[model samples]
Target: MKRTLVVGVDGSPESRAAADWAAREAVRRDLPLRVVHAWLWQPLAYPLAQNRDAEARLAEDILKETEGDLSHRYPGLTLTAEVLAELPVPALLRAAEDAEMLALGTRGHGALAGFLLGSYGQQVIAAAKCPVVSVRSAHGRPVALPEQGEVVVGQQGGVADSSEVLRFAFEAAAAADAPLRAVRAWNSPPVYGYSLGPMWSADQFGGLEPYEKAALEQALEPWRLKYPEVEVVEHVEQGGGGHVLLTAASDARLLVVGRRVRESSVGVRVGSVAHAVLHHSVCPVAVVPHP
Candidate 1:
């Protein structure tokens, strides 16, 4: 399936880096690239209902110049450019309506990106209709190579949340010619709270681990048959679910996650954990719908 990728460029060094990245990515997937540069009419300056006469023109000129440069630089790649008269964040979000993925460059050059998602990138990711990627270097840096081989996607087991995360994970893995690591987390019951009536009986505890393991296998069975090409790495681990997912993400090019609060096409809200992972994951995070 050919995916449409939209990338934002404000002509900043980082944005240029994003352009390069987007070019390479589009080529890898045989997808088209749409480059967007946004301009807004400044609302007011102090007590005055402001003047955007000069600023708007300048912004448009910059976008046009940058678009021309990108066209020359990525000659073989399919490209499209647009200059928006709307705010960068909202404009990008609107553009994303038809895009499969939205890409951006991290705007800050300091040591604090951990706490700062650039104003434009932040707003777009918070409510974007599709997955968003914020690049670290947009200009002279080398574009990130597409996933080398089968990419690995994390899967939690048995729990409803895990089931939801798996569908997106497997679909993405297949798209990238990657593998799916169907992960199931397990842990011993708390030592102090073990004697809760009949629930903690020796017989129940004795068969618990084996039963849970079977359940996990059962959950992944259909997926295994459906996507025989996706190398399935079933990881049954003893640790926290989030932590296990993070560890598995180390070698993955992209991690696909799902939100619990599924929305209609218009009101999609990527759930909190998925949001948190996006901010913290070392690789790109793709938030998928699992409702």
Candidate 2:
């Protein structure tokens, strides 16, 4: 149960990109990197012995290739590779339980089409105990963290709900020596044609901006003090949370968002804003689970 940074690889271009990103992050965090590939044995149509052996060999090859590439790039990094003989979703979930963070590559269809995450990726992100980062490869290769770009994080709710997200964002920014942009979005109260009582004033809607701005600043105060080296940019906007965060992260090196752990009869759920950012953000997206 050693804590390490884990990256899942599937021999796809996107997974290669994720492995590269995870290696860099591991170096930054001073943690070992574990490369994992899950191979689900499918019954062959003819049930040939060679087919099964070939499949197993391919899985090992994928791990070795990824390990060699990453080791070449990060010679000082401690790394290991393993192939799990299980379904991907459960294998990844188990791998993430003891990991500091888990990184997975998301397939990007096109610039405007956004990322396409399979059901397994969604399930893993929803249930992982540690933060899950969805990385998209740019130009069929790994996208480097921008030197001047900030680490943008969507901040909402109170300190209790947002503290984990902020902590991750600040630590990422501090590691990269980049600025941290904290964004909060608010919607004006809906106007009612008829006022029920004098307690309801039309001026209340216009005055919400200041209150929201103050709340965002207050929530960020402790984090700012804790990571004094991280330059913070506070953004308060009136719009949809997802859209606001996406716009702020247009030039970000990393975008951090929070997913509240909610239990349902069916399964765990990722919040709407986090879902949207995961699909559309151009930068690497980190979904941190919080209470």
Instruction: Evaluate model 1: give its TM-score.
Output: 0.68
The parts of candidate 1 lying over 4 Å away from their true place are: 1-3, 47-76, 106-122, 134-150, 156-168, 184-223, 262-272
lDDT of each: 0.63, 0.84
Candidate 2: where is the Cα deviation over 4 Å?
44-50, 108-117, 137-147, 192-206
TM-score of each: 0.68, 0.88
Best-performing candidate as measured by lDDT? 2
What's the lDDT of the predicted structure labeled candidate 1?
A: 0.63
Worst 10 residues of 1 by lDDT: 108-117
**When superposed on Cα atoms, how far off is each prediction in RMSD?**
5.9, 4.5
lDDT of 2 by residue, 121-199 (tens): 8888899999999997666665665546889999998888899999998989998888889999988656763454422
Candidate 1, 44-146: lDDT as tens digits: 5479554567665655665677667767876778787877767666788898878867887765332211111366565676577666766653244423544
